[model samples]
Target: MSKVLYIKANIKKEGESRTFKVADSFIEEYKKNNPEDEIVVLDLYKENIDFLRPEDLGGIFGPKDETSKHHPILKYAYQFADADKYIIAAPMWNLSIPAILKAYIDYISVTGITFKYTEKGPVGLLKNKKAVHIVSRGGEYNNTPYEMGDRYLRTILGFFGIQEVETIAIENVDVMGVDLEEKMEDGIKRAQLIAQKF
Candidate 1:
């Protein structure tokens, strides 16, 4: 069975966050379609992920000794590399991803683990993996230039050798005159269809 990593980076709780609502539907449908698949949930807020510090640099750039291999930061990289699929849930903040989500990305973007330096430049090591991004935006930004959260995420995932990436965005949630429930239900329906084929 494939291992699916569900990475939740929203600051708000599930009940209050529109992002979580869409993500929850996707995951529920995913579980139903792929019952044998293993799903690992990593909530950034509850994980209390910390930003990279000066002391953490040594373990990241230094030799992969026993101690360095067991470093907390490297643990995230290992977990990420082992996953066959990924589901990223995050909300747009300031037209970009949350800081905590970026911090988690830093932890997983380890050299010689997720990617390696080569003569042609850096090459991703993890191949044949796929990812889906689930996001909620207050306003419409999917095709606009102001979009950054999902754009950046897709770039980073590509850097990790994940070429097949899908996105499910629930946008215009807070826009005036928008039917919030209707929009959310539409997102949920799309999520379910994607899950069935995922």
Candidate 2:
């Protein structure tokens, strides 16, 4: 079965989050279509994601080090390395991903595990994995400089060897004078379509 890692960053709208509804619909359809696929949902709000401290960095790179002392971070890296696919659902916060999501990225970006430095450049170790990102934005900023969340994810994940990335966005959800429900419904429909092929 394909191991799918789903990372959830937010569920509430007030917190610059309006993507959960669409993400939930996508996940439901994905489960229905790919029932055998394993979906591991890591909700940042409900879980304690490890922070990449100096000591944790040492544990990852140091030879003959006590890896058990850094079990949490090591586990996170292994989980990331084992995944065949990934789904990240997060709302745009100030033109960037949520802080919790970024923290999770740090925890998983381990040297010699996710990626390794080479003579020419850094090479990603988690080969052949694909990722889909679901993002929500408050205003109309599609294809603009303000759109950084999607690009950042693609860059970082690509650096770790997952170059095949797809982004599904629910934009303009919080724009003033917009029909919130209708916009959301449209986003949900789009997400559902994406799920069918996901």
Candidate 3:
């Protein structure tokens, strides 16, 4: 069975977060469609995900000794690399993903684990993996320059050799006069459709 990694990067719970609402629908559909698949959930808010420190940098750049091999950060990278599929749920904060999510990305972006540098350039190691981003925005940002969250995710995931990436956005959430329920319903429908094939 394929392994699916579900990364939850929001402080708000599923009942209160618009992003989680749509992501929940997608995950539910995905589970129904692929009951044999394994799902691993990582809640950033509940986890002790911290920013990179001096020791972390040393461990990453230093020699591959026993301490480095057993470093706590490497577990995140190993788990990320082992997954066949990824689902990231977050809200747009200042036109980008949450800082904690970025920190998690930092943990997983390990050299020789996710990517490797060659004579030509840095090449991703994990190939044939798929990913999807479920994001909620206060305003419309898709297809616009202001949209950086999904764009950043697509770029970074591509860096890790995951080329097949899709995004389901719940937009205009805070816009005045917008039908929030309708937008949510539309996002749910799209999410469910993607989940069927994801």
Q: Per-prediction TM-score, please?
A: 0.97, 0.90, 0.95
Best by TM-score: 1
Model 2 C-alpha lDDT per residue in residues 143-174, reported as the tens digit of each score: 99988888999999999999889888887887
Give the range where candidate 2 is weakest over 10 consecutive residues by summed lDDT.
Answer: 61-70
TM-score, model 3 to reference:
0.95
Tens-digit per-residue lDDT, 75-184, candidate 3:
78878988999999989999999999999999998888899899999999999999999999999898999999899999999999999999998889999999999999
Q: Model 1 Cα RMSD, Å?
A: 1.1
Greater-lDDT candidate between 2 and 3:
3
Query: What value does the lDDT take at residue 124 in candidate 1?
Result: 90
TM-score of 2: 0.90
For model 3, what is the error of residue 82's alpha carbon versus the real structure, in angstroms, after optimal superposition? Answer: 0.3
Q: Estimate candidate 2's alpha-carbon lDDT, on a 0 to 1 scale.
A: 0.83
